[model samples]
Target: MGDYLVRAIGYNGQVRAFATRTTETVGEAQRRHNTWPVVSAALGRSMTAAVMMGAMLKGEDKLTVKIEGNGPIGPMIIDADAKGDVRGYVTNGQVHFDLNEYGKLDVRAGVGTEGFMTVVKDLGLRDMFSGQTPIVSGEIAEDFTYYFATSEQVPSSVGLGVLVNPDNSILAAGGFILQIMPGCEEETIESIEKHLSTIEPVSKMIEKGMTPEQILEAVLGEEGNVQILSTMPIRFQCQCSKERFGAAILGLGVKEIQDMIEEQGEIETQCHFCLQTYDFSEAELQGLIDEINA
Candidate 1:
């Protein structure tokens, strides 16, 4: 499969769960940003979690995840919507470090142990829902898990992983989120805790060719205990386009356009998300100025 997410419930709806395989999606991001292995792992894990959170929204709703850490990687930003479209970028994409004590990509070293995670959700309402939580772990997954429990007041478990090839391309990326519903039985919670303790890192499972469904099965329980609700395709999709950049140029007003035309004869604007560059020739800049005037 290209890339996809799974939405399901387990233990008779006492647990709300999500799982996704984002190898292709993260690979595209790595290619666009030229992220090194540690940077790829950091950005990929954040995107995987953000996309799963996006699935929790209703139609036309979206969310943005920002991780501003004190590490060398600086800040990472991700945007995801209800339709499984996600895009993201890191402030510094060339960061790398020796593996940590556990022999994993030193994501914490890249992400840093300080700073905050902020999530802004646009529910198509007059006011957006925003939450901020202290970063409990530099690892993206634990930080999001903390966000849920502290900011959203929902007890949840989040697992995210990304493996990069020696060449710094994405090898596998995937994650899962499990939430305990109100009034969930104690037994069910204990059961999930036990499974969580024993399950392998999600990236390893994905590297081993496990699908989202299988990942959830391993996390939740046997096939019978989990009820598959729906599946949505996921991908790295950017909302940027030449017209959007043109409109932004128009917003910059005629004076800036004229100055750019005089100085460079043309201008190039690159999108932070996809790194696609849009060029505006002198004529195009003049047209935008004309539109601004009229």
Candidate 2:
């Protein structure tokens, strides 16, 4: 019912899949960013995919997905960890347009036809992994599908959708990712492709109150074929805090804090992820200066 993702192996481990119901998670982001309808779709879809990709990691590992398109929405960034926590934002959240020919949000027009999607992974031992591919389609799902196939060399099917209300709130948001494992039979891949063509959109399934497990079954087309491995709660979670920002201020050295104490009397910092503001009094600034001086 709430936001959560499921991991499963289908066709007796010949395929790996992930499904998530992210309505509440995307709703929280919609409220925080006040994104318009089209922009909401773009940001929500990217966040949904990012959280699933995060689940692919382990321990302290994490990743960031950057979508830089040439349209009005500007660049979007999402950060996610292995723990099912995610946070994201768009450079321009107030942009929207009329529906396209299919009577759906014009996400392609809002995202533009060219640009790049990049993924950066932090593996926590100074070892990093990064892959980038041109945005094959401004639609978030196709772009990720291309990313995995071309960048990671894995054949994948990605379905992402977000529906917004007239009042600019999120109605439903969810997605599924299906990847063919090495040595998968030709028959299995053909069957999955056939189902992918017929299954309803991910947003519609979520709107109809389907659970993540049910969504996976719908995509895989066999209720008994999926073996759910794990489930984890997902949400719009930001890691920024006052202490983290304070350390950043201290890294700015003594003169900057002194200037704030004298010229501005205090310093205030606002987090881009959550828009939460942190203020440091003149005394607090002085203490930071002392720490820098010491």
Candidate 3:
């Protein structure tokens, strides 16, 4: 099935749950950024979690997740919105290393532990909501779990995993988040911890053809209560274009555009998001100047 996420509530609102299959989403990002095995694991895990987090919002609200780890992979960035739109890139996409002793992708080596993950949320307000925390674990799922429990003060369990192929491509990618709401019972909390301790890694479950619903079931158990909220598609969609680049030049003011016109007769800007280049011809630059002065 095409990649998508399922949002649900469990135990009659005592918990909020999210699960997603991000293979295709991560695949698209791999193609766009040309990421290798280690970087793919890091980026895929972040994207999977970001998609689930995006599903937590309402219309026109969005968020950005940034991991500035001091590892070979450089920075890992992800963006997501309530409409299921998401995109991201890694600065050094070709980073790779030997698998960890657990025979898994060395995401820790790719995304070192000496950095931070910061989230910027746009809730359609004058000022965006943001949170930042140090990278407690280079393994993204734990870091995000820490982010929620500490930064947001919400008890959460994050299971994010990405299996990489021998040829440095994504094999499987997915994750889930189970959050405890206010007034949760002590028994409910113990049940969740027990399930997490025994449950398989989220990526392994995805490879076994588990749907988002099934993933949630794995976490909540057959006897557990789950209320489906909504489902949404997920993919790599970059909202970058030449027109947006032109507007950026306008923001630079008339003199900057004029300097470009005089120096090179034209200018080209490349988007870091999609790596797509935008060129403004001399005439276009002149028009931008006119618009700026107007």
Candidate 4:
């Protein structure tokens, strides 16, 4: 249907896996950001992986994925929570390049290899968890695989893909994460590796209308080894609003509001994630100032 993900255990709990279809979600991002082909692919791939990582969290937990590479596309930031809500934006959305030798969008050329992928997890604890790893591959998927192995000590296989149309809209976007649990048998690893080597690209599978369950089946085999745990609906959702922004404005104190009223007469704020603009008139600013005085 729209956009959703599936979580499952394969090989009798030896491996935990996730798969998601994010065509619509990425399409929304493309429209919002007006990203060129390569930029769209990079942002979509990061969003796809971040949402699956989000699913790994529990209640009220959230995470931010940042890719700061020394490339034309600049930095990309994605925010996702345990409830399947996600939103992101790239610093430079209008970047594209010729296809690579593989005849795929040159995401690596646009994203650059000399940078870091940082993940910050807000687990509702006093101390948040943060991990940083080098961007081994600007292709996005392999970079995350490396992050899990080197930073988190989890051996994981990540497959992320995004296809863009001639009109620059998203054609297909999806991904899968397969993590080897502790005590996984060598035979199970070999079987999983075999399937991984032969399976179609995730974007092709999504273009073929494969559901997340089917993707997991393709990755983990079809011998009923994959036991689905649950499914979660996902979408590009931004947690920004006028009231929230107004509260933030109020936090700037009465003097700041007065300065804004004197300088601009009205205040306009734009959300970096969704590009939604919010305006506060002089009267509204005065009211906030009065509240601050009160």
Candidate 5:
């Protein structure tokens, strides 16, 4: 199924929930980055959660999530917009490790235990909203949950999962976030916690053909009244292009362009998100140099 996410309200608006299916999106990132199993799981989980959070905003709004850990996988960085477009990259996407004691991907080992997870939201305001917290666990879900509670001061439950194929490709990837809004009843909080602990991993549910709505239903229960707000397609999208990159070269000044023309005869630039490379001929570099001088 295609990647998508939904936002909804349950229990008469006291509980806000989000769910997403990101298998294809994660698969694309895995192939582009050539990440190993553990690295794929760690990065995929954060991208899944970031894309869903991006859905919480209005037009033109965007958010950036950063996982600065001291592990072999290095830092994880993701950018998502209100339109369900997201792109991310890891400092070390080729890190791998043996399965954990539970036989799952060693996300904790790949992500490291000492670091911080931060989210910066650009709401098109004078000051962007920012939240951050030390890593409670290198497991992405718990870390996100802690970020919400400690930084945003919102009580929330997060479940993020990514299942890797035997060959290190992404098999399934998805997650959910259920936040208790102000004035939520005690019973509602208890009910959600009870159900969350028993549900299967989010990736497993997505692998079983469950939609985003189904994931919410499983978490909120089949009986609760859930009102869907919006549904949007989610994918691995990067906003980098040759023209934009050309502008970057112009920023390096005219002499640098001349230096490149002398040294390499051409220039090559690569996008980290998709790993796509762009080449400019010597003439093109000369043109940029003229523009920079002008």
Candidate 6:
């Protein structure tokens, strides 16, 4: 019903898979950013994949996915954590185009055929991990598929889709990821490829009210072959807050706060993820200046 993701091991641990129903989550993003149809698809697809990747982490670990393409939509950035929280935005949310040759949102055209997809992971402590791959397809799914194979050295299949309503709202958004574990039999991989070719798009499945578990079964073939290991709720969650922004203002040092107090009288900061604005009065700015000097 609501947004959630399923992590499962299929074929008796021969393969690892993840599927998520993200309609509501993507809807929240669309409403916040007011993204056009094609841009909505691009952002929705990236968010879907990023949340799943986030599940691969543990504890306070988090990761950010950045797609920089040479198209009208500009660069897109998404951040997700191990807790199933994700937030994202496009450089230009208002960009859109007529349907492509397939009568679907022109995501490839909007994303462009050249660019890079980069992933940066913060593992907490002093550790970090980063990987990058060229944007082979501009379609979010295939680009991630390539990323895993080349950057992470895992053979993977990724399916992502987002349908937009005429009013520029999200109609359906969801996706699935399948990875061929080491020692997987050739027959198992062949079977998954066969089912992948026949199943409907991920967006259509979500539109028909298919749950994430059902999606895994359909993609992996046969209900008995897929074993769901865990399920976690997902949503469009931003870590930004007024207090956090205030702390950032303190980090700007004493002079900047004094300039705002004297010249501007106050400061207003708007979060790019959720579009929530935080206003600091002159008194509050002075307080920050005091803290900085203290």
Best by lDDT: 4
Give the clashing pairs for model 4.
none
Candidate 4, number of clashes: 0
Off by over 4 Å in 5: 125-127
lDDT of 6 by residue, 76-151 (tens): 9999999999999999999868888888888999999899999999999979999999999898999999999999
Per-residue lDDT of model 5, residues 1-294, tens digit only: 699999999999999999999999999999999999999999999999899889888899999999998898888999999999999999998886888999888899999999999899999966699887898889999999998888888899999999988888888999999999999999998888889889988889999999999999999986558888989999999999999899999999988889999999997899988888999999999999888768
The true-structure Cα RMSD of candidate 4 reads 1.2
Better of 3 and 6 by TM-score: 6
Off by over 4 Å in 2: none
Worst 10 residues of 4 by lDDT: 219-228
> Whole-model Cα lDDT per candidate?
0.95, 0.93, 0.89, 0.95, 0.91, 0.93
TM-score of 2: 0.97
Worst 10 residues of 1 by lDDT: 219-228
The reply for model 6, stretches above 4 Å from the true place, is none
Residue 82 CA error for candidate 5 (Å)? 0.7
Model 4, 73-146: lDDT tens digits are 99999999999999999999998699999999999999999999999999996659999999997999999999
Clashing pairs in 5: none
Candidate 2: residue 24 Cα off by (Å): 0.4
